[model samples]
Target: MAKSILIVDDAAFMRMMIKNIVSKNGYDVVGEAENGQVAVELYKKLKPDLVTMDITMPEMNGIEGVKAIRGFDPNANIIMCSAMGQQAMVMEAIQAGAKDFIVKPFQQDRILQAIGRVLARAEQ
Candidate 1:
């Protein structure tokens, strides 16, 4: 079965771009969220195989979301996203327990590669 992924991005356009990339590569998009809090809620509700999450967002950021989801489920597979100039925050998110991260503006190969690696880890 294709890996089920939950996409979390503040911009609808970004979400759509990622969804298109992920789905086209044979992953199942289980859901999408606009912020960290919602991403956590959706994580519990969906229990997707992996999550692609943006670093900056309202009502909480990806670092906090990573921590929260990790708090709830230490084994959750989360990949953080970030734009340029946010390397510090990206590092923090990774330390907070994200399995990995991808930088935007959405390189198709990197995004798919991150998801593939995360799913492979879950399989092992």
Candidate 2:
């Protein structure tokens, strides 16, 4: 089965861009959220195989969402999405329990690679 993914981003364009890439590459996008708060709620309800989360958002940021989700389920597979220079926040996301991260303006190969690596960890 294809991995089910929750895509969270405040920008509609970003969400669509990611969806197109992952779906074409054989991942199932189970749900989408525009903010971390909604992401957390959807996570509880959907329990997707992986999540691609944006770092900056209203209501709650990705770091806080990562922490909250990890608090609920330690093994949740989360991959943080960051802009060009958010290295500090990306590190924090990892420390908060994100499995990995992908830098945007969405490189197709990198995004898919990150998903593969993060999901593959579950097999071990």
Candidate 3:
């Protein structure tokens, strides 16, 4: 079966862009959330194979989201998404349990590569 993914970003356009890319690449987008809080809830409900999470959000940030989800499922596969110059927070997200990250104005190849690499790691 195709790997299921949950997309979480405050920007609607970003979510749409990610959905279009992953869906076209044969990954199933199982759910979307506008913030980390909702992403955590959806993570519990959907139990998706992976998650693409945004760092800056209203209620909860990506680092916190990664922590929360990792708290629930220690082996959860999560990739952080951030804009340029948020290197510190990206590092925090990785420490908080995110497997990898993709920078915004997302390059299609980079997104695919990150997702592919993370998912492949999970398989082992």
lDDT of 3 by residue, 1-124 (tens): 9999999999999999999999999999999999999999999999999999999899998888999999999999999999954778777888899999888787999999999999999999
Clashing pairs in 1: none
lDDT of 1 by residue, 93-117 (tens): 8799988878777689998888888
Q: Ranking by TM-score, best first?
A: 3, 2, 1
Candidate 1 wrongly placed segments (more than 4 Å): none
**Regions of model 3 farther than 4 Å from truth:** none
TM-score of 2: 0.96
* Whole-model lDDT values for every prediction: 0.89, 0.91, 0.94
lDDT by residue for model 2 over 1-124, one digit each (tens)?
Answer: 8889999999999999999999999999999999999999999999999999998999999999999988888999999998844778767888999988888776899999999998899879
